[model samples]
Target: MVNEMKVAFATEEKNGLDSIVSTKFGRVAYFVIVELDNDKKIKDNYIIVNPGGEARSGAAIKAVQKLLEEKVAVVVAGAFGPNALVALDEMNIKHIVLSGVKVSEALGQITDKL
Candidate 1:
């Protein structure tokens, strides 16, 4: 089970906090993994390229698997595909969606709500 507070943000670029949040979760070029402390502040961050980002099919499944492998407990994106949503549910991963926001902003909103 996911224990650490790791949040994945779907972004178009490989930037950490500065990356722009991507509207498309499965097709996003990168997933910015941010590690949060107990107080909900960012402790560290990294980027992972999506291998199946441009795939015509099964992209969502692959993306979800990748995030799972990284032990992500939550995901932040502008949107999530149907398949991805199902996969996340099965994996017990929480997700937050925010449109037209930067990765940093999305993180703040999610933490505030929690």
Candidate 2:
């Protein structure tokens, strides 16, 4: 079967739907990876710990690299640092800013627009 495009969201928790949108992109504790079918239905989801969180400097670049290695087509975060933004743009990864929302709600909004 063909795989659909994958999206990643920086979140505060590990649980799928219950995860909270994190305020900082690079420093976020977890990255929730969600796979969507062509029809925009959620197919699968998982979480990864952000190793860049412990970096004293260059955390944003490291985070972007990690996400790129994951093959994520899009990234959703509350906010991104300048370096991270530039790197994401260079890598052709789409990014969306979303704060004060649950992961489920963000998914709903994204799918609705899709």
Candidate 3:
């Protein structure tokens, strides 16, 4: 049987796999959720507008909470706020930081590790 997992990418736009990875995790505009099969190939994907992007405070925590609801196994971004990193650690969600890369490239870079 093949194992599958879902990874969420903090993105600057809602352009699916072509979306640029946002530099800031908490204030990102969108979250691209990609499901990967055991072979490290994309099985499915979608996008969600980040509610925490417009928050005045605790945006990182809010973003983490939103991802938790989606049940993502991992998260990818250019950078993670201090609070966001702590939250993700406590929640046991894995995170990868890859700056200035498109969502597709980020996936390619991390495929082997995932």
Question: Which candidate tops TM-score?
Answer: 3
* Candidate 2 positional error at 16, Å: 1.8
Ranking by lDDT: 3, 2, 1
Global lDDT of each model? 0.85, 0.86, 0.89
Top of the candidates by lDDT: 3
Runs in model 2 deviating more than 4 A are 1-3, 112-114
Residue 35 local lDDT, model 1: 92
- Please give, for residues 3-104, the per-residue lDDT of candidate 2 as tens digits: 588889898798886798888999888899988998778888999988888889898888889999999988899899999999999999999988778888
Alpha-carbon RMSD, candidate 2 = 1.8
Model 3 residue 79 lDDT score: 88
**Which of the predicted structures, 1 or 2, would earn the higher TM-score when compared with the native?**
2
Taking all chains together, the TM-score of candidate 2 against the true structure is: 0.92
Those runs of model 1 whose alpha carbons end farther than 4 Å from true positions after fitting are 1-3
- Error in Å for residue 22 of model 1: 0.8
lDDT of model 3, residue 63: 92
TM-score of each: 0.90, 0.92, 0.94
